[model samples]
Target: VCPEDSNDSSRFMDLWYTFVDPYATEVDEMGTDEANKSVGVLRIKDGRKIIDAYEWKHDNDVHLLAQNDELIIYELHVGDFHEKFKDLTTKIEHFKSLGINASNINSYFFF
Candidate 1:
């Protein structure tokens, strides 16, 4: 669809939207209905478009560098570790005793 086809070029915009079609490579959140998703782009290395079919592949796990193996990693759950700074301070000695040189935590959705 084009703006000129709409008969009001100034007010009309040529908008394109994708839906959960059979040709979709993958669906976000596994939505089955058309209105709930957007399709991935299908194209060739030479810029040719794929119109009839799509091949879906699951993402592969990324392999970390060799240096990653050398690091001492201590995984911790921040919310479970402590409720406040004072509480955390009380565990400093315990943490030090663990002899862990590094720590990683994910607390973004802890509510």
Candidate 2:
């Protein structure tokens, strides 16, 4: 499976490609593999080097603190926590463990 080891068929540089129809139903219309049909990263297989930068990393240091109307509030839909009283109590304790306020996200994920 080594390209450089065997020095097999000669290779040449080719143009990077994408398709108007991503699925590529016709022979003329080329497309990516089914697994790469959606938005994600592309890489060079040899050294696991990333050549495509579709999505960039987010800045983790940014924080926003607002007052009154400027401040955004979040309401969590606590379903499983609402089921058992002990779960709600434990969930509250878990939320308090985090420095900032957190939500109960175990309830519904739509999955």
lDDT of 2: 0.50
> What's the TM for model 1?
0.33
- Taking all chains together, each candidate's TM-score versus the true structure is 0.33, 0.22
Model 2 lDDT-worst window of ten: 22-31
Over 1-111, each residue of candidate 1 has an lDDT whose tens digit, in order, gives 345457754673456565555755444554476555555544455676455455556568675543666666677665675556466567767766876555676673666
Name the runs in model 1 displaced over 4 angstroms: 5-67
Query: Candidate 2: TM-score?
Result: 0.22
lDDT of 1: 0.58
Each prediction's whole-model lDDT (CA): 0.58, 0.50
